[model samples]
Target: MDMAKDLRGRKALTARPLRLAAATATAGLLLTLAACQDGGADRADDGQASIVAPGRPGEKSRTLTPEQAAKAKPDDSPNAADQSYVQRMIEHHRQALTMSALAPERAAADPVKRLAERISAAQKPEIGAMQKWLALHPAPTAGSGTTAPGHGHDHDHGSMPGMATEQQLKELADARGADFDRLFLKLMTAHHEGALTMAGEALAGGNNPAVEEMANEVVATQSAEIHRMRAMG
Candidate 1:
């Protein structure tokens, strides 16, 4: 009886290890299957492939998904109103720069000279920005060849409102001392008003977001400058 008991005890111990091993293997397999299912779900949630899209000629490239690309609008292709604003504003800003350039020699008051400098500084950068925008979307007049560097086009200068006539510019150029200051302020104020008019038109009719942003900036800055120039006078 004792020998039979020992054999049965050993057999029970051996069977216990086999059962534990089987349970551990089953648990491991279940855990592996669970992990695989979670990984598959994660992949499904983020399955869209990334693609690089080209921007406007001078602009940086952007990344988008297939869905985003499908919904995206082509804002870079400028409309007729946008092109008109750019072309006209370029000439307008150039004339302002011409007026501002006379300030150092012609303006008598220190404040007037400083104001002219400020105007020149502000408009130069804006002119460059507009020119760059134009370069990206060339005008119909622009041949297949590269567009010229500055606002050197043959557009009619008198067509824009608030521009000083040739007689007025000549008068401003010839004036001196306190006379120059008063005339400078007056002419610049008129020029700024014209810019406001153009900007308002752009806001109403222009289609490009960039042009609209520029117009809004012109309205704000030129409006403030107009008030300041009036106060100076």
Candidate 2:
């Protein structure tokens, strides 16, 4: 009976170790599974998406993750395209204002004068906005020289599409009554069209959200004006 009891005790000891090892293995497996589940949940929480852009010939494609493409803060710096667009547009609008100023005294038609008034009202505020944007941004030295208020006269009129030549401006300044009305309509129509072209370019190339919004506004407002001008003629 003593031998039998000793044998039973040894067997019990061996079985206890095996049971403990089994429990340890089971716990380890559960922990591993839990870690994997947590990792998946974290990735889901990140809310990141990806975009793949096609590469040029012989080049690898690029991917933009959500973190990279996320909307920028308002104070984010402007790009070259944004600066150029703002500067050029400010000058463009200034010239339009100059032409519009003439309408009160020179234009014969009420509709023409009203159109001029609308153009002036719209562009003056836009010029101010662009000026403020430029003040905040402060372009590089090369681009900076062009940004002075009322300094648009220094620009080469030939470079800007639809800009009135010095001679044409002189003629507009000299003309009166019906001639002035006709000339103003033609010149303003072309000017607005040029503005549309510039705004479209800015929208395509500019990275700044504020500049893009302004460019879009320019496109919409000037498009409507263009239609009105066409109808008036």
Candidate 3:
């Protein structure tokens, strides 16, 4: 009976690791297979970008025509899942930009100001990238930039996580000196954490290389920022 118990324990331990491995492998595969068809746009590529899906050893090559390729380009209304990821990240980074803009005026420590500067530098371009992707992308409607990445999200655009309401932003803008620094740190930290959550979700469910790469970068960079904000807080 003791020997039987040991065998069962070993099997359980082995099975646990296998399950985790399976999950990780499945996630990697999904990212590699990124493809989306809006229930509506029904359009293929708009005109420019093309995704050359990596070749498997034996499969015949598949290439999308310019029109079909254009269809794959990022759109404002990313699927409910992809939109959730994109929208929340955009809002999170917007707050960081606000915090960074305030640094010149209120941050007492050069380090805090420097961190804010870095945050602004990094996120501004990324914001443009994401926004441009959304613009080029075809959607069922205009101005519907709200892809969630993985989960079929249904949150109101106005109430996404990491987004500060108009009133909250106005309050932040009104702050001065150490008050600005304190609120900025606190808010940015929360914002960074929210981005991490969205990125993690994308890593688990997203397929597009562009989307996956962006999500991975968000996870690593924002994670570092969380530590930076904590130290500076």
Candidate 4:
């Protein structure tokens, strides 16, 4: 009986280390997960944030200090070009919405009405996105020869490419039936062309990835719509 008791005690002692090793591993895993949740960075015992920068292909990732991470970060901040593009595009889209609004009441062709609906549906959400982006990343204070990027603050809508003249808009508003259909298709086609030009300029000058993505979407969507309009015409 004493021998059996001694063996049992040995087994318990052997299991303790295994259980302790498992607990330590679990704690380490939890710490690693906590670090990942904290923005791909880990906090040291001293409470300093440490960045985990991934290396090139076939290379191992290494830790970096905050200063190093900042230095390594790409210069993707929104520039004046980005701000201007977004601000102007918002106005541009509003004009498109205005034209589209007229279609439901005046358009004679089913295709024209459908096209107008599509334009409104696509552009409204885009306007919301751009507005949200602008709100999130406010423009810098105005300086010499520059204006703050606010709605209608400094931009002249008439001067923007593809914007219909006030006379043209008035004409569109007055027209009905086939006249409205012809005019809407013509004006929207031109407006989309203008959007393409603006997007190209943004792609060339803007530094922010968000601006680039928005510009690319404009180019792609407008280009397709332009083709469809041409075929319709």
For all predictions, the C-alpha RMSD in Å is 27.8, 26.8, 13.3, 20.0
Q: Summarize candidate 1's per-residue lDDT along 1-233 as a digit string, tens digits.
A: 23223333543443434334544544444444455456532222377444445444476855555455445533334566677788899889999999999989988899899899989889999999999998887776555343343333665679787899999999999999899999999999989888877776665655566887787678767877887898999
Ordering by TM-score: 4, 1, 2, 3
The clash numbers for all candidates, in the given order, read: 0, 0, 23, 0
Candidate 4 local lDDT, 1-233, one digit each (tens) = 23223333543443334334544544444455467676765777777777666554586866756566556545567878888899899999999999999998999999999999999999999999999999988866556445445433477878889999999999999999999988989999999988887877776666777887897788767877888888888
Q: Write the per-residue lDDT of candidate 2 for residues 1-233, one digit (tens) a residue.
A: 23223333543443434334544544444444355456632232356434333344586844444344232112335666687788789878988998999999998999999999999989899999989988887776645654444323344546766677778888888989999988988999888888877776666556676887788778778878888888888
- What value of lDDT does candidate 1 attain over all alpha carbons? 0.72
Which pairs of residues collide in model 2?
none
TM-score of each: 0.66, 0.63, 0.58, 0.71
Better of 2 and 3 by TM-score: 2
Query: What's the ranking of the predictions by lDDT, best on top?
Result: 4, 1, 2, 3
The Cα local distance difference test for each model comes to 0.72, 0.70, 0.61, 0.78
Error of 2 at 100 (Å): 0.4
lDDT score, candidate 2, position 163:
75
The better-scoring model by lDDT among 2 and 4 is 4
Name the top lDDT candidate. 4
Residue 41 lDDT (model 3): 19
